[model samples]
Target: MKPAAFDYHAPATANEAVALLADLGDEAKIIAGGQSLVPMLALRLAVFDHLVDLRRLDELGGIEARGDSVWIGAGTTHAAVGRSAEIRRDIPLLHRATPLIGHFQIRNRGTLGGAIAHADAAGEYPVAALTLDARMHTLSPRGTRDIAAADYFTGMWSTAMEPDELLTGVTFPVWRGRTGFAIEEFARRAGDFAMAGATVAVRLDADSRIEQVALGLFGLAPTPLRATTTESEVLGRPAADIDPAEVGRSATAALNAVPADIHGSAEFRRRIGAVMVARAWARAVEEASND
Candidate 1:
């Protein structure tokens, strides 16, 4: 199937792209790498009267270190991100999650901003951003603003961004000290979206106590979710004393609105989610202990 007929505008600057979006209103959609949007368009899942392309906006593509955090432009391709040494060293969670996103071909054309803005429940970037407390920066006719990852995702394939707001970049905070990160998921096949997945980040004290820990779950809810209940339950506890299996169960226990589809039933997803959380938690803790 082919996409519906639409007018295309490739803007040379960020300001110009947003201006086009504002002028075109809801009828216009922003196209970056178009890895996700193109498929939706081809299937007629999404239709737009106009598309404001940002491919020519050089300002929206780059990776920079900003003191304690790393800022990645929305237009930066996933392949670029996976190849970035700074990201690999500073934000290992995101670095590790990159390869799990579809395949090399998808990553070659998929932009960071497109993945986060698309806000798919099963997307690796969204779960990694949520786990790392990344901040999303946006530009609009009204001005600029930043949204916390926790508050950014609103529902399945939905976000808090307004119609005219263009996501310019994202800043992921770097975890210092004895920190470790791991991500685990269950997919039916290679390069397929996971049935259930978990990303875990942990920081341990010198004495092997859990100083801070975050568990982000994907493919088990309407939106990517943080296992705050399980996090609070295990925080400050001795690393050796906590049971990863129990933490996994607690992570998925209170989850509501777990999706049920041909992939799997909600209960089955919860079971798979628990196993993922456990595996991720164990690996993260082991890495942190050795750090």
Candidate 2:
């Protein structure tokens, strides 16, 4: 279906994009990759009087390594992140998860910022950002500001972003210690939205004991959920002696707030979430020990 009639503006600069959004106000939507927004537009799930296109904005489409963090442009595509040498070497978890998003075609068209702004519970970017304690840079008519990843998410598809704000970049800190990353999910087919999924990143010391662990879940909550309970349990312990299934069960209990749908029941999600969490955590352990 054709999208509802809307004016389109392709701005060449970030300032121009923000100005357009400020001028259009709530009637405007900023589109980068257009993978998610286009579908919403076509279905009339969203109607805007104007679209502020940011694809041409040079300031929002590159990756850089700064002092201690890896900065990813808001307009950077998933394929770019998946193929980046820096990501593969520094943040391998994100590198592995990027290819699992949608499919090859969608990855080429989906923007990192778009996915974060869309805030789909099942999307990989949100969890990855949160797990890494990433920071997002946002601009609006008011001015530019940085927001911590944990505080940015408000609800399903909702964020701290103002109507006129455009996300410009995301930056995540690097860890020097041994780290492991893992993701597990259940889907009817490759690239389909998951029935349930989990991603975990763990840091370990030379002794093989956990230094830190961040656990996140998708398709089992309104927003991508950080499994604090599970993280608390695994930290300071080596993966070898830890019971993944037990830790997973604790994490699974945190999904009590997840609403049920035709895809699965609350109980089923709890079960699957436990399984995924266990598997992902185990992989994280292996990577920490071997790598």
Give TM-scores for every candidate, taking all chains together and pairing residue i with residue i.
Answer: 0.99, 0.97
Clashing pairs in 1: none
Cα displacement (Å) at residue 86, model 1:
0.5
lDDT of 2 by residue, 1-291 (tens): 889898989998888888888788888888888999998889988999988888788788888989788999999999999989998888777887897899999999899999999998888888889888899999988889999988998888999988888899999887667888898888768998777889989988889999988998888887888888778877888668998998789888856676688777888888998999999988988988887
Q: Which ten residues in a row have the lowest lDDT in candidate 1?
A: 12-21
Candidate 1 per-residue lDDT over residues 1-291, each given as its tens digit: 999999999988888888998899999999988989999999999999999988899898999999999999999999999999999999999999999999999999999999999999999999999999999999998999999999999998999999999999999999999999999999999789888999999999989999999999999998999999899999999999999999999999999999999879999999999999999999999999999
What are the clashing pairs of model 2? none
**Cα error, candidate 2, residue 27 (Å):** 0.5
Model 1 vs truth, CA RMSD? 0.6
Identify the runs in model 2 with alpha carbons over 4 angstroms from their true place: none
Candidates' lDDT values, in order?
0.95, 0.87
